[model samples]
Target: MPTGTPLAASRSTTERHDMTPSDPGARRAGADTTLVRHLNRRTVLTTLRSHPDITLSTLGSLTGLSRATLSAVLEELTERGLLEEHAPATGGSGRPARRYAFRATAGYVLGLHFTPNQVRAVVTDLEGQVVARERTEVPPSVPAPERLARARALAETATSQAGPVWSVGVATTGVVGPEGRVLRSSQIAGWTGLDLVGTVRGWYGRDAVAGNDGTLAALGEKWQGAARYADDVALILSGRPSGQGIVLGGRAHHGRSGAAAELGRLLQDQTWNAAAVLDEAGRTAQDVFRAASEGEEEASRLAAHLAHHTARAASVLVSVLDPQLVVIAGELTVGGRPFLEAVRLQLETMCINVPAVVLSELGDDAVPLGAARLALDALEEKEYALEG
Candidate 1:
């Protein structure tokens, strides 16, 4: 588990509003009531966001809050214009029920995705809809300073058109620890042991959060792409160095050091040279898939080789943490049907349970949309938390 902000980094498994009388509960209750109230407001907001038309009565039941306590928090949030109450439902029962929902336009969020060859940015309203998007080629030899400058410039460009940037979320290809620290990376050359979050905050001076690219991609797929409503899942990104994000019990499992499910650096061959693989541009994993698709015999054999290695890697994942779905993204799987067909066949032969494998439906926007979800999820406004 992460350690920082109570809500984003570490919140108990149960909803925050529920007051449990346990050893941990004693410590929590002994703290400031204001903090608990704030958490309760956020809890209410998340609950309402998930069920848009939830009645006040249902809200209390879901969050395990008493009438008076729920009313107080609801009143505060509504007064702040973060939540809005709707007219009671009429014509169904003897007494109608009053419901509430998040005010979708209460604020704006910015999402940025940093790929090896490109940087994508998007601005979205509170509801996580992409209002604007831009992508730029990353410099060939992307030094850390240059990448930081590019991220800052791109974020400024995107936020310039939005009303106001409430929060910013950045996704990168690496082992990013909680509090936005990069533990390591096999793809981006100089990103290892870097303080990505601090650098971005220094550059933009905005409330920002950074995460592993695949984690954000999975979140985006759950929000606006494929895997919507999926619980146990993995997101596979096929780039120069592929990666996977693990989602268990409907949430990303950010491990103790924040590098729990990083699959890219899973060393398949100790002698495999990263530079040599990148030099043979035609030898990219995607190119191999394309060749096979075009009926080239060599391409077919190499594609099978790639599939076998990939399946073996996936088999490791299944043996440890079995997921329900695996979504393939990036140029490799963008071939859609054929790519999925071959990969699925290969994976089924290796795994214990045959997980549903599919190509990313979010197209090129998968990472950017994922950044958007991360941004919204980090909002101070409580209601945004409720989104499934």
Candidate 2:
């Protein structure tokens, strides 16, 4: 599991209220007791989610909620089936304090990712544990409509086995519009100007959310991969064509047009296209890496050349963004430590202040997990709105 501050921790703090006697009347006039109760409920629930199997007394100490208020909130949550209480061990003398925990199975969220060749879906419980997953491959020659349908079908199949999906998040390759449409995609055939979110919602019969695959991949790293400890990061996904995702102040930075970090576009050299580079050398990217591993001189030179170009591109981002860490993701990482060392070597020479560079631990699953993380955020928003 990723080891930074959990996403739920930052959101769990209660909003402070003034209790000065001079402003008592004004505060009372502006205050809604119902809103206060909801806030208290959210605080308690979020706290319990982070620290499971905690006694009520411990929760009271952590939240500073009076016993009366804490009891009321816990009771309400328990009644709503959002929390569960378990009895303590019998060895304790007379009576044991009961422990309360978040009911992870209370709801589910769906995460879907669509690429030129495949559609992947994952269903996660409220606590972000995978409950079910499905994947389907679509030939590159398939029409956009058919590809979209297959993706939707895969999502539906995953959701059906995972129970009620409270929220859905979709990640795809392209410049995603504010309204969740794919504005353009060079890799996917006839994918430009498609209403991706609308297609998912239309098929699933519920509102669904969407984001760029690169950005989501960065979020996934934060949530469960190599960048877990870094607040500011740049995730460079290397493949046929590379892409980048930026995280600043512990949040994904989607630029004004949601196309903030299109690193592949910055490269004017042929090295940017892995397929083209491999074709020229009469070897696949994987084959090149394998041969280089076996000490083949030609393959070693090719790997070094690709690393230099990648480092050149990455140095520009590092110089401008100054992120604490840079994560190399996608197909290039298949080369393993040798590829990472080569990139790091070039980066150290080019960069004035070189940040730590490492390979992505999540591989292809990063985007889908990041989408699930987004779905969890959406679920929290919906819950808050309902309570308010």
Candidate 3:
């Protein structure tokens, strides 16, 4: 069968039967068949992506599909260049059965992080493996149009050798609406009212997605970082401006107006703004943590002060959402156990119930990685719609 041709089960049964053309039952059966085929194809693709190089027999067992159905699906995928068949490498086998793997290199996706000081881009394949990355420094004094142009150039450079890009995702520091508009951003001057999605789509000639950096960081952790196993998570992203992202029931919760967990905006009577505090000391959050790690009393004092504010912010989230895991992400967490332990201790004291608080494993790449994931998801949705 041709790659794009519908499977027998997905075709109209009325065409195969001698029933009248106006038979309602036959039409419903055909529609049901098409829906079932679409679902089965999605299931097979999902399973193959999760378990690459799986034997056909193993795939059938994992997907619970009969041999005939599995064979048809595999043939179609292979014909479409989305799946590759290979002989199993076993020394004792009489005849190695063919194994199948998703073709990760078939297409690529672009992810970008646009900030006041820097623009970073990453190219990933269908399997979410990083293919290429580029970073460009953008001085704060640069005009908004110039900064955006530079960001676009960086994205183009990053994906130059990655082949065809299926989708694009951009992560920015601000309140990003569902339609990809930057509603508000204090870090980047004149950033509000920017059509982030439109700009990115123009650059790549494909539909794009945009999201808040902190929210994407939470998704990054849930996708492949520290919070992978947690169903409900709150991510505290510490940087020049700290922010928070909440994930409940395995999805990022972007509240009304897409500003749900703006932890930096949370009111506190006596809060320690880590960025402001460190700036007053002529140091960065990383510098304070480094000094504390080296046993500097003054540095430890500053770290503790910052921890107090972080814990206080977390306590509010814990009290309200009661997440299963609280993740401390970004450059500050690079201080390792000292920073995490300090924050953990402070949270234990403030919260009525302390959840498992830990540090993010993805570090600086979290936002970009999460953006790539969003692009991948968009591609999957498009494919599913076409199939359906």
Candidate 4:
């Protein structure tokens, strides 16, 4: 689990709302209180997320729940193994208080990221710690069905040795439509019009979800990377399909058709995807970036070409959204400041308002971690069924 302020250290999950306990003398006990009880449970669980070793008093304070109601919620959670109690600790002079923490190991989630050149899968606990991982390299010529089968096999194998998995999330290279359907994927042959969400669900026979890689990476960055504090952000991932994802007001901004950031077709001729350039040069992005940073002319020229196109698209997005920040992900991050400066310089000329552009700290893990975050959403928000 990440050691920082709860979830996004700089943000709060649920605001402290005044909540009153139910009347004990009600005639109908189980009829009316079921939904309320469930809500209270969710509140406690959400409050404890990434916030550990909290005493009852503090939990009550943060949640604004009455002591009696808070105690009942904690007892229910402890009974369900979602929380664990720690030994009593003496603090400032009152009686010792028993602390409780959310048990991240209560259940697990599977996340998979797929690009034209590679497939990566990870099984992470509820707190986003990778417990198992699998990867494979595939030529772009591989058929879509074959690639799907390989993805299924890798995902199944990755989760075999881990704890019980509650749900699965997939990040793929394409314009994802409603219900995880691939609206279009020109880079990978025969990949368009696939029912990705249903396909992944068949693999696990449980809850599954799918989304565009760049879009999910945006969510991942907000959850753990550079945009945690930014109210609005735009992210460009220079991987296969070279698309963008937008975050507005701390939530993903998927347009009506889930194609808000599908800029691959427009970018294909202008900006060569970073991996394709690196692969043809027979060099890694890191190697190219390092040489460019040292003032190598050839490397610097190639890096500038990539930066120019990235900035063009970013400039358009900045003009429209006027976001507070912009993030560069995937191979482009290795170029660091030189690449960013080039992009920023170009952006300044094209657009009057330019936000601060930075490299993604989550690196290759961004998509997968974001997929895990998606799976968690399935468990907590959508279906609201994590059984355990």
Q: What does each candidate score in C-alpha RMSD?
A: 7.1, 6.0, 3.9, 7.1
Instruction: Candidate 1: give the clashing pairs.
Output: 45-383, 46-386
**Once model 4 is optimally superposed onto the true structure by TM-score, how far is the C-alpha of residue 77 displaced, in angstroms?**
1.9
Q: For candidate 1, write residues 1-388 as lDDT tens digits.
A: 2111222222233344565556588546545444675568777877977999788889989999999989887766655556777899888967888888977665677788887777889888777767788778886478877887787788788877765566778888887889888888766768888887787766545567888887777777777777886887788766544566767776666778778666545755722322234355457666666777889998777656555555555566666877788887765664457657777888777776877887788877877787777766666544324321
Q: How do the residues 104-180 of candidate 4 rate in per-residue lDDT, one tens digit apiece?
A: 88668888998888888878888888898789987788998999999988987988868666788888887888688
C-alpha lDDT of candidate 4 relative to the true structure: 0.78
Candidate 4: regions farther than 4 A off: 1-32, 90-96, 239-241, 265-268, 271-296, 383-388
How far residue 237's Cα lies from its native spot in candidate 4, in Å, is 1.0
lDDT of 2 by residue, 37-73 (tens): 6678789988998899999889999999999999888
Give the clashing residue pairs of candidate 3, or none.
none
Evaluate candidate 1 by giving its C-alpha RMSD to the native, one decimal: 7.1
Worst 10 residues of 1 by lDDT: 1-10
lDDT of 3 by residue, 307-372 (tens): 888777778788899899999987578668877888999998888889999999987778888888
**Model 1 segments more than 4 A misplaced:** 1-36, 39-44, 50-75, 84-100, 203-206, 263-266, 270-291, 380-388
| Cα lDDT computed for each candidate against the true fold | 0.70, 0.79, 0.80, 0.78
- The TM-score measured for candidate 3 stands at 0.87
Error of 2 at 354 (Å): 0.8
Worst 10 residues of 3 by lDDT: 4-13
Full candidate order by lDDT, most accurate first: 3, 2, 4, 1
Identify the superior model by lDDT, candidate 2 or candidate 4: 2
Task: Give TM-scores for every candidate, taking all chains together and pairing residue i with residue i.
Answer: 0.75, 0.87, 0.87, 0.82
What is the lDDT, from 0 to 100, of the residue 232 in candidate 4? 89
Model 3 C-alpha RMSD to native: 3.9
